[model samples]
Every structure is written in structure tokens, then in C-alpha cells.
Target: MASIVPAEKIDVIRRIEQLAVGAGLAAIVQTAIKLGIPDSFDDGSVTVDELAKSAQAEPGTLGRLMRALTVHGVFDEVEPGRYTHNDLSRYLREDAPIPIKYLVLWMGAAWTWEAWPRLTDAIRTGKAVIPDIYGKDFYSYLGAEGAAGMGDFMKAMTAITALSAAPIVDGFDLTGVGSVADIAGGQGRLLVELMERFPHVSGTLFDLETVVANADPKLLPGGALADRTTIVHGDLYDKVPVDVDLYILKNILDAPNQQSDRALLNIKESAKPGAKVVIIDALMDASVEELRVTTLVDLFLLLNVGGARHNTKEFEILFEKAGLKFLGIKPVPGTFPTQHLAEALVP
Candidate 1:
């Protein structure tokens, strides 16, 4: 056995302590989001006293949190004690692009806070702590909360997707694809962007009835493809548009169980025999460090909607099940290895 050096031991101890400190800081941000601190600050800068009054926290306590958060680059300490939205905190604003405020509150304060504390139970049992924490699966909880909860969850997902959007646009080619259909495309954002970029490509944004109901034409700016874009309300488990030459499914099947095959089969059945089907979802290779994040995503899907991330083999099975032939599995640059752009042909 190798003897432990005193200095090395001290270093390890310090790193463990730092991890605890990071967890504490995250807790503070959680509390702030739960207390509506971000929303309050969204309008403009406010003094600690004003924030305290709004949050119903004592002046002294609130000031301390604000200072710590400012140091962390979340909020800005604009004039010593006064505070304003920094880039990090502004992202928590409800109307801000991706609007992760409720998501922060939900995960940080709600599910994660409870789930993490009982991680030992999960470890021992090798079972999800979601039912134990929330008394139900995550999706059931959200479905019970109705549209408001769904909107928050989707916003959080969109926030995550937004981070990798630029890389996606760059990695995938849309130059010559004439008719594109975005299956289970929420709110039509990605398809709209793709259509706007490739003026020659007409598109359809397909989503659930409720989701398509909320889509607005104004979201797609360029008039060149305006007439070409249609919002189609349909169930991916049922059928996909037949005439579309290009089919894109982004982060759709990761949410539900066995629906990946269902969605793909539908797309394959209706698609032109040689139509391109692009599947963009979390794909984990056997060797990768960000595999932890991918693993967590699997749990998130299981706990939330009985869905999960697929390995390369699992994806191949789906392709076979769907009567689609694999064309390629490529990685988008500047993203995690688990994020794969799997292109298949509807055969």
C-alpha cells in the first residue's frame, strides 16, 4: 500500500470542503429563485432593503445573500449594497430567453433538494427517489400541475437546447433539403430558424395539439419561407407527414418510453422511401466523462416520463424497428460526446 502524504491529504480535504461550499452557494441561488428574488430584480436595480421587503426576508439576511451571489457573478453589486441583474441572474427572468427561473425553483428547491438528500436511499436500493420525494413520477407531478408546469419544464429544456443551438445549425446541412418536417418540434423554434436560414427549404412544424395551438407565424421572420411553413398538429406515436422529404426529430424521444421507435416508425411509414431522417438526441458512447450528465439525463427521463437516453446499439435497434437504415452517427463540434446527430434514411 502506498503511504498517504500529509500535504496530499490536506489538498484532498480542501477540495472536498470546496465542493460543500459550492453546494451551499447553489442552495442560496435556489432560495433566491423560490423567494421570487430574480423576478423582482428583473424590472430594474433595487436596494437590499427593497429586495428584503419583497422577499419577506430580514434586511440583514438578504443583504448577506445578495453580496455572496454578486461575488459569484450572478447578481451585480451595483453601488455597494444595491443590486442589479447580471447576465446569470437575468437568465432567470421569466420573459428572458429560455426563462429558467421556475426550472431553477423546481429542480434546485423542489425535486433535487429532496432527491439529493436521500441519495443514499437511492444508492442502496438502486431505485429512483422521485416517487419518494414527490410522491409520484415527475411527469405525473407536472401533468397534475397542468399547463403552467409544462410551460416551465419546456422552457428549461429549451434553455438547455439554446446553449447548443449555434453548434447544431453549423453541424447539420440544410442547403438542399426541399421539404423538412420537425416531428414533435415544440413551438417551432428550431424549424423556424432552419427555414429562415435556408430560403429554398419549405418546412412543417409538427407537435401536439396544445403545442401547435400556441405557435405563432410572427416567430418566423423571413417572408421568403413564410408561406412554406405550416404548423401541423399531430401525434408522433400515430403518424408523421408523408410527403416531407426531410424529417428532423430533436430531443423528442428522450422524454418517453419506447416512443423513440414509435416516432421513427411513423416517420418511416409516411416518408418518401429515400427521405432523410435526422435524429438529434442524447447519445452516449461507452467512453466519455460527460457520461455522468448523460446518465443523469436518463434518470430524469425515467423519473419524469419513463423515457431514457439511448446508446449506439439501442439507437440501432430503433432504426431497425422503424424500418429505417442508418446513414451515419456524427458528433456536433463543441458539444458533449453523448450528443449525437444520427442521420438515417427512411427505407
Candidate 2:
């Protein structure tokens, strides 16, 4: 007979088991969102039959999926065979205020899902495998696939940027800054939020012409910013709005170190003396959780884009090399998502 496992080893075994089925768990959640199963519960408690009917799924199979998600707190079975929205499940609602449906969709998308298995190849080659695996770079594929898929990906990214923007706007001080440039500010979400917060601060929304062209309706919803915000279109490596007091490069450094250096140098050269270059990203650290998310994102950049996350030391080196002085780093508070604000100055 097999030897009985020790109690200490039991937790480890359980952890391993959990990790083993993690993908299936993620798939369950994704399916629930995709099927609009959570939408059925919005009115109140819903039977599996109702959820299945609404989602056009068979009752028995849908019930199994719901049961698996319930075990992981994605939904609550209030009564036998009936489900209701729990805290987690509510966010998957089709019209959730903080819509994560897109995130679920993107994460579970075929291309992204397929790339994970090639992680070892990426590490070995020190190059992105997405192009090799998918026959195109990620963005090119997204573009070629047409707007629907790209829109979903952009929506997911916008949701993530929205979550991070609040803590940043509240945490960082932006007083007396005459003008600001949000480099690669997609859809103008963060810049709009910041502009709303500081009415006196005129802003320039600098990004690709294509990106800015599609940014109407989502680029701050009022005339208040009409006079204050200018949507300037250009590549960051080539040019940014010069002489801006503050230039925000939120989550833009996820490139190969050399490319990041060139981009930083471009910004530094354009920036007037003593201007601030604020970089917002998850700076790598010693904490396990920090390492987990940041390193995975770093790997993601490596696999798809050619970018990587920077530790403080790495940022220090990048800043020094780019003709900018490291000003220090600040942590954005609130548990939604923690990212470090690395401030540097053009010398």
C-alpha cells in the first residue's frame, strides 16, 4: 500500500493540487463570463436551469461549471441548485461598473492561452515566442485580426489602467505643474481623470495618431477639458511634446532595456531642465507577491513585446544612462493594485 502522507506534507500536496487545476479554475470563470451566466443572476438568485437557459447551455453541464466556480468563490449557491452574485461574480456582470469581462476574455483568449506553454522556449532563446508561435507579433496579430479582438484587448487594458489611475491620482502630488504629457495614454482615461482632478493643469495627450484618432467620445466627456487638453500624436521614440513640466510614462517601460533607454533619452532630451519624468509600473522587489505579478508581467513583455520590468537598481541605471537623475520612488496606496511611482528628473 502507498505510505500515508505526513500532515506537514499534506498542505504542500494540497497546494500542488490547487496549482495543478488552476487553469481549469480559470477556464470555469472565463466560461461563466463568456456564457453570460453571471448576467442571469443580476436580478437575484437564479437556478442553474435559468442560468443554463439564459446562457443557452445544458442544465447539467452548466451546474457542474457553477459548482466548480462556487468552490473558488466566483459565485454563491444560496440554495440547492440556485446561484446568486457573490462579490467576485458581480464584477463579471455584462454591465459591471468595473467591467472585468474583457479581462477574463483576453486572458482566456486562444492566442494568449497558447503562449503560456511556450514559456520555456522564451526563457531559453531570450526572445519573444509569440511571433514564432502565432506567426506574428502580438499587436500585428491583433490588428490583422481586426477591431473586435483588438477592442476587447484594449478594453481589458483600459480597465486595468482605470484601476491603477485612481490610487495614482490620489497618491501623487501634481501641484503647480503647468502642463503634462501622458506618453502612450490610451483612450485618454488616465489623463482625463488627472485633468478633472486638476482643472488648472492644462494637458497634452501624446500618443500614436491612430490611437488619438479613435479616442473621441472616451477622451474626457466634457467641454471642461476642451481648452485644457491637446491630443498630440507622435511616436515617443521620435518625439513627445517638448517643455512639458511633467511627462507621465505609465506602464510604458515594458520594452527591451535598450529600447527603453532610447525612449527615455528621447523624453529626457525634449524635457526642459528639472522637468519630472514619472514612470508608473510594478517595480520588481523582494516580496513574493510583488515578484509573482511583476515577474510574470516581465515575462509577458519578453514573450510578446521586448520589454521587462525594472527594479530600483535597474531604474537607477536606466535613469543615469538617459541623462536623467533618479528622484526616488513612491508607492501608490489602496489595495486595488500596487504600483511604484518612479520619479526622475531631466538634468
Candidate 3:
């Protein structure tokens, strides 16, 4: 193990410089995706001229950008003027699972990226930079962006859930659990998958009315558990639906002090005695470096959303604060895990 002594200024400065370079590269990729170039490239290999033409970009200018991304392995310069999509770029394609194309574009949008420049403001005032950036709370700002942008938000969250939901689905045992409620679960994608895989287990997806309306009904095909699949239109802050074991909160709970407090309280009230409450979220550990780019991800939540990554101890305290006790915390293996599955029981 190595210690980051402040007196070791060279190491610290190198790390800071790396972060800046990475952020710049991210900005370029973000701009390209938002312009729909990646989605256009999925048809097959194409030269920069072809890519730019189809993407409606200036051919000469796009040539330089493709060279830049190619140097970094996003695209491969197959020959002097031919280029092909690489592994990293493939995820930006339309059919890719958890297509990060929109997610990256959303996160790197001017509103979000602008907030990082004022990271100090959030740290000093203990206020979220989201309101500072968007002139409203993050969730409210989603509405202010108009229906199209709200649709983007829903799609972006669905993509995120597809990636983050694996930990809970893989680590937990659902042996006797017949029904589950996904609290603040938008669109019910996870619930649909749960019901499909474990036929014995049914699910109720509780989310906002707008969210339910926007959800693709294909996810809720009417059938055996389709009758069992339920959608409760309400806010998790107000009330969570009752009388179901195995409540899961997938990537929820980033807010001001009181907001987080109220959310936990609501979950506690919704649960019966001894019901399992599963929390799936990013959990920092001493070995965060073991996972690729995970440390930067911690800061991403903090600078963007005023949310800092927490360790098991922080989560345990959160559970105890809301009258719940920790059952266990487990690391999901064989995947790029951005979260830890922490299960607790309401006392």
C-alpha cells in the first residue's frame, strides 16, 4: 500500500493533471455522441468523410476529431483513410445494452459539466451544484427542460439501471420471496426482468405517474405475473406502497440532508416488521482503485449531484437512522460493479 503524503507533491499534481486530461477527452466524446455520430457509425466501417457526411458534420473538421478518438482507441484507423468502430465505441451504437451514448451526452451536457468548475462552491456551502447550474433542483430541472428532455431523462435513467441493477439481481437470494416492490423504480425494467427470470416472484413497480405513463408498455406484457405486476403512481417521498417483501431501491436517494432523511423514513414506514430492504448504490472501499476509473466515479456523483460515495459504515448508519438494521453487504463478482448490494431488515 502507498500513502499520499502532501509533501509528495509530484504524485498529487500528476493525479490532478490526469483528471483534467480525462475530463477534456470526455468532453470531446460527449459532444460527438450528442451530435449522433456514434449512432450513425453502427452500420459498418466508414471513413471520416462518410461518417461526417451521414452525421451532417463538416468533413474536414470531423476528420481531425476521428483522428483524435482513433489515437485513443475509440476508433481504429484500419488503413490510411479507413476507420472502424472499436470496442469502446461499440457501446455508443444504438443497439448496445445500456447504451451510454445518451447517458454520456446527458452527463456531459453544458448544465452538468459547468457545475464541476464550481466544485468549491458546493464544498464550501454544502449545497448541490445542480441548483446552481440549472436554477432548480435536479429533479425539478428535469421537468423544466420540457417533455423531450424529460423523455431523455427517463431513457438515461433506464440505461443506468440496466447497468447498475446487476449487483442486486446477482447477489441476493430470492428463495421464498414471492413479491417485490421497486421503490422509485422508474419504468419497471428491473421488475420485469425479475419476474421473467424467477417465475415464482412477482413485482410491483412504484414510481411517479408521469414515469409510469412514459414507460414502454412492452415491458409489462399482460400474462400470469403480468396480472401480478403492479404500478403505483406516487412519490417515494410521500409514501411507498405497502405489504410486499423484498423492497429494492435501485440507485435512489441523492438529495439534501432532510430529503435523504425523509426517504429513509418513508421506506421504514412502508415495510412490515422483518421485511428485507435492499439498497443498491455505489459503496467506496479501500480497494476502489482495483476497479477501473471508480475513484473518478465517486467524484462524478459528488461534483455533479452533491452526492459523495459512501462506505459500508456510512450505509449502516443510514439504515440505523431510519430504524433498520444491517443484514449484510456483499461484493458482486465477475463484472464492472459501480455499486455494492447492501441488504437490511426493518426492526
Candidate 4:
């Protein structure tokens, strides 16, 4: 084969094939997870018939699905017609620290998955395709879907936070910062973690009313963090509360529309002079693997919310426009996807 065709061309074709089948693989994985197939193997390697019965799936069909996933290294076919756990498949476990189950469910959601086919349309129209397909904005759809919908969304965010928050909390210097405010802080995960770590510093968790109402009770009223953390409900674009020394805009600025600028300005206005604003997000200009990840995320932002991941230079421009002084961007070491702590000072 190598003699007949150049290796480079063959590699290109292989990559295209992988990309083409990406959605199919995701669908299979999502289906298996939703069926609790991974949990069925907890006792050890199980035959196709046993596993299928446990997962409530057809034995032959589920066997084929498991074989395909095994080819992708999601599970181990220790012997013919039997499967067991692998590093990749274990993530589907219900109690995994970073439960990827929720992330998979959210990404495989109808509105989200359907929008990918309209990426070209979004590019042509210079708008997110979510509204065109779903007849409403992403957040509005989540709201209309009610508690179960929003809970899954929060679970996905919480999973991501579980991985990144520890690195972020330890990376920054929180000493002497009298108070901190986490804007659009979903489930108050980061704020709760920070307050627990730095008991000397008080913190406020700010987000939309519905989001705050669904925040983890362990972080709110009469809970572990209640004494040191105040959970407030409000839109980041409208107001971010005032008089906090540190304003954390972790995932806030990456929202669609002009919310980034408006929210940054709101934080600027709400902050006292010399307040520190830290943006915890993935920045461009990283290693090849990191760039690939961040670039994919930037595209997803376009598809989901009309936002794009930014580099330090782009953030400098945003801060300048929002009337804040750019301090610098610091990398949060020991993170999986690796994020930056972009710092700016309120003027």
C-alpha cells in the first residue's frame, strides 16, 4: 500500500475518516452511558448476553456496539464476546470525580448536536445556529426545559470545575484580598472552594436568578460555606455587585453576544478602584495539543453561544475597551486542559 500511495496522503485520508465518524462514536458512547452499560461490568468481565441484559439492551446489537467502542479503546475485550473496564471507559462511571457522563449528555443534547450541521450557516449569517434550529437562545431553551434540563447543564459545569478549580485556587495569591466576587459562578463551585481554602477572605457568588436558585446547597445558606460566602442572584450584564477586592470572571466573558463587554464593564463599574479582576479561561498561543483543544472549543463557542476563545492580546483589547488596565496572563499549572488566569485592574 505504501508503494502504491504516499504515506502523507494516506494519513490525511485516515484523519478525515476519523473526523467523519466522530459523531457516530459519540452517539454510541452517549447511548451506552445513558443505558448504564459501564456500571454493568463493575463485577468484572461480563459476557455480551449478561451485560446486555443488565443494560437492558439487545444482546447482539449491544455486542456490536461494544466491539466498535473496544476498537476505539473505550473498553477491553479480554476474550471473545466479553468486555471489561479500561482507563477511558471508567470515566462513564456514575461516581467518577470528573463525571464525563454529564458532559457527554449535554454535548449530545438535541439542540447542541443538531447545531453542528449548521456551522456553515452560522458562519454565513454571523450568528449562532442554536436560535435558528431551537427557536430560542441557548440559555432561554435551558430555562424553558426547566429544572431537569438546567440540572444537567449545571452538572456538566460542575464536572469541569472539579478538574480546574483546585489548580486555580492554589495558583493565585489570595492573601489580604478582603473580599472576592465570582461572576456567573455556576453552582458556586469555585467560590465555595476558594472560601473554604482562604477562610480569611469573604466571597460572593453571583449569577442569574434561575442558576443561583439551583446552586449546590452545600455552598449556600446554612451550609459549610454559608458563613463565608454570600450567594447572590443577578445577571452579570446588569450588575456584579460592588466593593469586592477580587472579581473572578472565570467563564463569564466567553458568553455570546456583547455580554462579554457589557459584563466586563459592569464588573468595572461595580468594582472599587484598584480591584483585581481575574479571568480564568483557555487562552490561545499554546502548545500544539493545547492549541488544538482550544481551537475546537472556540468553534463550539461559535456554534453554541456566538463566543470565541481569546488569547492574551485579544483580552488586552477587551480590557482596554472595558476601561480596565491589563496586568498580565498567568498560567494555571497542573490543569488538564490548562487555563490562564488573566489579570486586570479596575481603573
Candidate 5:
């Protein structure tokens, strides 16, 4: 007869089993979103048959999906055969006040499903696998895929910006800053938020031609903030042509070191003495749970961009290498992944 295992040991084994099959859970959630199940109903509880009719899915299969999701707390099953949205499930709605549906979709994009399996190769080579798999870098691959691929990514970035922009602007002190430039600012959402918060501060949006072509309507000519906003299209690796009191580099510095360094040096070449640069992104130093999340993102970056999230010292080194004086970093309150604003000044 086999010796009996302790109850705690059996629980540990169960947890290991859960971790082993974690991908199934991710797939289930993505499937629900793709089926439009979240948007099919409102606050009221609906039967499985009603949900299936709205989603155009088979009632039996859709009920099974709902049962799995409800068990995971994504939605609520009020009784045997009825379900309703919970706080977590509401964010999956297409018209959520703080929309994150695109973000969820982007995370499960087709490329990601292919790339994640190659994480081991990326770790072994210390380079991105996207190039090997797609025959180009991540951005080039996105460009090649055109709107079908790039649209979800841009919208996802916008969704994330929607969540963090207000808090970042509220916490940032713009005193005496006449102008600010958002470097590689996708769609100028953050820049719009910044300009709105500090009416006295004029803003510049610098990014690629393709990206800036779709800048927030408020930043386009004849729009409300257009008079105070300037849109410039150029590559950051080549140069940053805007000279402003403050340079905002948000979520764009996670590229490999050479590119990140070059971007910073380009900014230094353009900025005047005493100009300030703030790098806003997630920090490696975080609570255990936050690290658990970011570490996965860190590897995801590795698989796509050959980048890693920087700790405080690594950030200081990046600033120093670019000939800027490192100031310090402070947490941006209300940000998920706990973004930190790392500051440096031109010497």
C-alpha cells in the first residue's frame, strides 16, 4: 500500500496542477470575450439559452463556458441556470466606462499565442523570438499585418493609457514648465491629458508618421488643443527634434538597451541645458504580487522586443549613460503595475 500524503502536501500538488493548466483558463476568458458574451447582457441575470442566442453559440457549449467563467469569479451564477456580470466581468464590456476589453483581446492576440511558446528560446538566446518567427521586428510585423493586427494593439495601448494618464498627470508637477514633449507618444492621449491639466503648458507630440497621423482629435489641427499642440513625426532612435521644458517618455523605453540609450541620447542632443526628462514605466522593484505580474510581462517583452523592465539603479545608469543627471524616482499613484516616474535633468 502507498503511504498517505499529508493534506497540506496534497493541496500543494493541487496548486501545481492548477498552474500547469493555467493556459486553459486564459483561453477560456479570451473565448468568452471573442464570443461577445460580456456585451450580450447587462445587470440582469440571463439564462444560458438567452446568452447563447445573443452570442450565436451552441447552448450546451455556451453553458459550459459560463460555468467555467463563473467558477473563476469572472461572472456570477445567481442560481442553477442563470448568470450575471460581476465587477470583474463588467470591464470586459465593449462600452465599459473605463474600457479594457481591447487590452484583454490584445493579450491573447494570435501572435502572442505563437510567441509565448517560444519563451524558452528567447531566454536561451537573450533576443526576441518575434524576428525569427515573423521575419521582422515586432513593429514591422504589426505594420505588415496592417489594420487587422495593428488596430487591436493601438486600441489596447489607448485602453491602458486611459487607466493611467489621469493619475500620472495629477501627480506630475508642471510648475514653471512652459512646454512639454511626449516622445513616441502613441496617439497623444497622455499628452492631451497633460495639456488639459496644465492649461499654461503647451505640448508637442513626437512619434512616427503612421502613429501621429492618428493622434487624438484634440491634438489635430482645428481641434480644441491644436493651437497649443505641435505634432512632429520622426524616429526617436534617429532624433528627438522638440526642445521643451519637460520630456515625457512613457512606456516607450522598454526596448533593448542600445535603442533605449540612443533614444535618450537623441533627446539630450535636442534638449536645452536644465531641461528635464521623465521616464514613466513599471519598475522591477515591487511587491510580491506586482512582481509576479511584471515578471510575466518582463518575459513577454523579452519574447517580443528583447527588453526588460528596469530597476532604480538600472534607470540611473540609463540616464547617466545618456549624459543626463539622474534625479530620483517616485511612484505614480493609482497605476496598475505600479508605474514610477523616473526623472533626469540635462546637465
Candidate 6:
């Protein structure tokens, strides 16, 4: 006879098993989106055969993929052979009120698949693995000609900006701020939203030349906000060549510490004595569920850029090191991954 394991222990074992094969779940969801399965059906339940026809997949194998997704609660299998969209699945639709399809695609992009496996090496060296694998930095690789999934990555950034821009702008008090600079703001989506919200605020959009070249048309010449918008192109690490009443660095400080420091110092060097500096990004200290999501992102940043999300203390230290006065941080409600506004002043 053999000794029996406790039920709790068995559950633990099952959880570990699930964790081990997590990649399969990611792959299946991405496959479903790529096959056009989510968009193929409307609100009504769909049969495997109908889905196969709409998605152009083999009925038998598509059924297997559906089973995998349904088991994860992504879709509901009401009948043995019929499936319908659940709340979770509906967000994968292209026209979702709050879109997430591009974000999902970006997470499962080809480069991530290559980079994740080298996490161990990244941890050991305390550096990014992208350079070793791709022979260049993460941005360089993404911007390289003929790069796979580059379009999806850019679209994903736009999707994220769309989701959080309203809340972020609302949380910020731009009173008395006549001029603003969005440093490293991709395509200036948030900047456009800000300028539209505060008609009196003239804004500057700064980023790499490649990125600002595609700035929102409204921010470009002859567009709605063109007269009030200035597009500057250069590396933030080299210099931030703008002086404004307020500077917004949104989700761009997730590079190595040296680079993040350099960015803050550059802002400090260029800003006026009382200029406001806002660093908006996800904080490390958060609820368990939020941490569960963000910790993975933290590690992903490490693998790609050797960056980590900073806690309040770490942020204070960062500001202090760069010779800026650390004010405090406040949560920006309704943001996914939960962003916080860490503010400072050029003194």
C-alpha cells in the first residue's frame, strides 16, 4: 500500500502543473486571434463547424483549440459543440469599447517568445538579454526594417495610451501650466489629448526621430493642433531640449537605472526653477492581483532593457539622485496595471 497525499497538497501539485504549461495557454489565445476566431462570430453561440468555416481552420483542430481556451474561462462552451463569447472573450474583439487585442498580440509577439527563454541569463548578468540575442538594443530591434510584429507593437502602445490617457490627464492638475513637454511620448497621443482638454496649453512632443515623424496628424503641420504643437526629435538620454512649465514622462523610464537617471537629470537641466516634472508609470507596490500582472511585466522589462518598476522609496531616491525635489506619488485610478503619478520639482 502507498500513503495518500492530502487534498490541499494535491491541489498544490495541480497548480504547479498548470503553471508549468502556461506557455501553451498564451500560444492558444494568440492562435485564436490570429485565426480570426473571436471576430468571426457575433453575440450568438457558434458551432465548431461554423467557426471553422469563418476562421478558415480545420474543424477538428479548431475544436481542440476552442476547448483549450474554454477551459481557461476565455469562452463559454454552453453545449458540447457550441461556444459563445463571455465577458473576458469580448475584449479580444477588435471593436471593444476598451480594446485589448493589440496588447495581447504584442505580449505574445515573436520577439518576446525568443527573449523570455533567456530570463535566467538576464538575471545572472543583471542586464538585458536583447542585445546578446538581437545584436542591438530593444528599440533598435523593433525599429529595424522588415522587423516582425513591429506594427503590432506600435498599435499596442497606441491602444494602451488610449485606455489610460483620459484618467491620467484628469488626475493631473495643469492649472497655471501654459506650456508642457511630453518627453519620449510615442506619436504624442497623450499630448494631443492633453492639449485638446486644456485649450490654453501649448505642448511639445519629443521622441526619437523615427517616432516623432509619425506624430498624430493633429500635432503635425496644418492639422487642428499644429499651431499649438511642436514636434522635436532626439534621444532623451543625450538631452531634453525643451523648457516648459510642466514635463510629462509617461511610461518611458523603464530603462536601466543609468538611463533613467540621465533622463531625469536632462529634464532638471533644461527646466525652469519651479518647473514641474511628472513621471507616470506602474508602481511596484500594489495589490496582489495587480502585482501578479505587473511583476511579470517587470521581469519582461528586465529581459528586454534591464529595467524594473520602482516603489515609492525607490522613486524618491531616483528624484533625489537627479537633484529634483521629490513631492509625492498618487494613484491614477482606472488604469490597467495601475499607474501612479510620481511628481518632482526642478529646484
Q: What tens-digit string does per-residue lDDT give for candidate 4 at 178-291?
A: 899888889888887888788798888888788988777877677877787787887777876656999988866777637888989888877888899988987777889888
Model 1 global lDDT (CA atoms, 0 to 1) = 0.73
- TM-score of every model versus the real structure: 0.76, 0.91, 0.86, 0.94, 0.96, 0.95
TM-score, candidate 2, is 0.91
- In TM-score terms, candidate 1 sits at 0.76
Which runs of model 2 end up more than 4 angstroms from their true locations? 2-8, 216-224
Candidate with the larger lDDT of 1 and 5: 5
Q: Tell me the tens digit of each residue's lDDT in model 6 across 1-347.
A: 54487766888888899999989989998998999888988788999999999988899999999999999988899999899999989889998876688888989988889999999998899999989998998888888833354567667887898899999999989888999999999888899999999999999999887778877899999999999998999999999999999999988888888999999999898999999999999888999998988889899999888898888888889899999999999999998778899999999
**Predicted structure 5, TM vs. truth:** 0.96
Clashing residue pairs in candidate 5 are none
lDDT of 3 by residue, 187-278 (tens): 77777667777778868888777787765574456545567777777877787766688888867754443656677788788778878888
RMSD each, Å: 4.7, 2.3, 4.7, 2.0, 1.4, 1.6
Please list the residue runs of candidate 5 whose C-alpha ends up more than 4 Å from where it truly belongs after superposition.
Answer: 3-5
| Winner by TM-score | 5
Candidate achieving higher TM-score, 4 or 6:
6
Clashing pairs in 6: none
- Clash totals for all models, in order? 0, 3, 0, 0, 0, 0
How many backbone clashes are present in model 3? 0
Cα lDDT tens digits for candidate 2, 1-347? 65499767899999999889878977998888879787765757888888888999999998999889998998888888988888888888878887778888877777768787888998888888878976887666776767676777778877888887777888667776888888877777788888888877888877766567656353534656777878788878776655699998887887778878888988887888978988887777747866765677788778777568778788778888898889898778862457788888888
**Per-residue lDDT of 1-347 in model 5, one digit per residue for the tens?**
65487766998888999999888888898999999989988878999999889889899999999999999999999998799899999989998976688877887899999999999899899999999999999988987888878778788888888889999998788887999999989889899999988999999999878778888999999899999999999989998889999999998898999999999999999999999999999988999999987988889889888999889889999999999999999998999878899999999
Model 1 stretches with alpha carbons more than 4 Å out: 1-26, 34-47, 54-56, 67-73, 76-87, 93-106, 109-141, 216-226, 255-257, 286-292, 334-339
Q: Model 4 residue 328 lDDT?
A: 92
Q: CA lDDT of 140 in candidate 4?
A: 84
